[model samples]
Target: MINKIGKITIYVNDQEEAKKFWTEKVGFVVKFEQEMAPGMKWLEVGPSEEEFTTFVLYNKEAMKAQNPSVSVGHPSILLSTTDVEKAYEEMKENGVEVGKLMAMPYGKMFSFNDQDGNNYLLREDK
Candidate 1:
């Protein structure tokens, strides 16, 4: 039987920079980190220590070299927040590239980019 989401893999150019962006800018915590191999590391980060799912920041070049069949692309991740405006403002103040907030019948949402330029949506459900 299927359970909840385990982890999401995000291939990045620089693991350290990505880690800083997620932890410092995006306010994610480092759940786990270890050296998988020489010049390769396995890093897991999430919103909090108690969170179930995490984002695994993998070394893109190393991963691609190890697995040629690996598919690396931008993933549309929708993050829920209690206040979309506040989240957007915080992200912008933290120097994160953010898109304009949009209002929809469902909720208010905005998009922000990580250091690696991967865009993620933040929504405040009404």
Candidate 2:
């Protein structure tokens, strides 16, 4: 049986930017790195508050499972943060395009897109 959403793979056009944004800016640790396939690179960023990791794959074969060629679907990915405002402001200051904070019936959320145009929703943890 499936245990949980193990990992989310995010395809990136720029490895350097993705590494910087997910690591330095978002506070995720770089789990590992190596050559994914000939010219492609593999860098996995671990979740700051959880036991999950997001893969930054470049090779076509590695990204093949993400269907229709999209690694994610609607709402793409949801990352939990302690402070949505601070996270939003920090990302914005870094020239990362993000949406304004909005209060939902569940919690606060702000959207942002990665270097690959993959959308992500950042929510505050209760």
lDDT of 1 at 20: 99
Pairs in steric clash, model 2: none
Number of the predicted model whose TM-score against the real structure is largest: 1
> Which pairs, if any, clash in model 1?
none
Q: Give model 2's clash tally.
A: 0
lDDT value for model 1? 0.90
lDDT of 2: 0.72
Supply the TM-score for candidate 1.
Answer: 0.95
lDDT of 1 by residue, 5-120 (tens): 99998889999999999999989999999997778789999999999999999888887788889888867788888988988888998999999999998899998888888888
lDDT of 2 by residue, 21-53 (tens): 777766677877888566667777876546665
Error (Å) of candidate 2 at residue 93 is 2.0
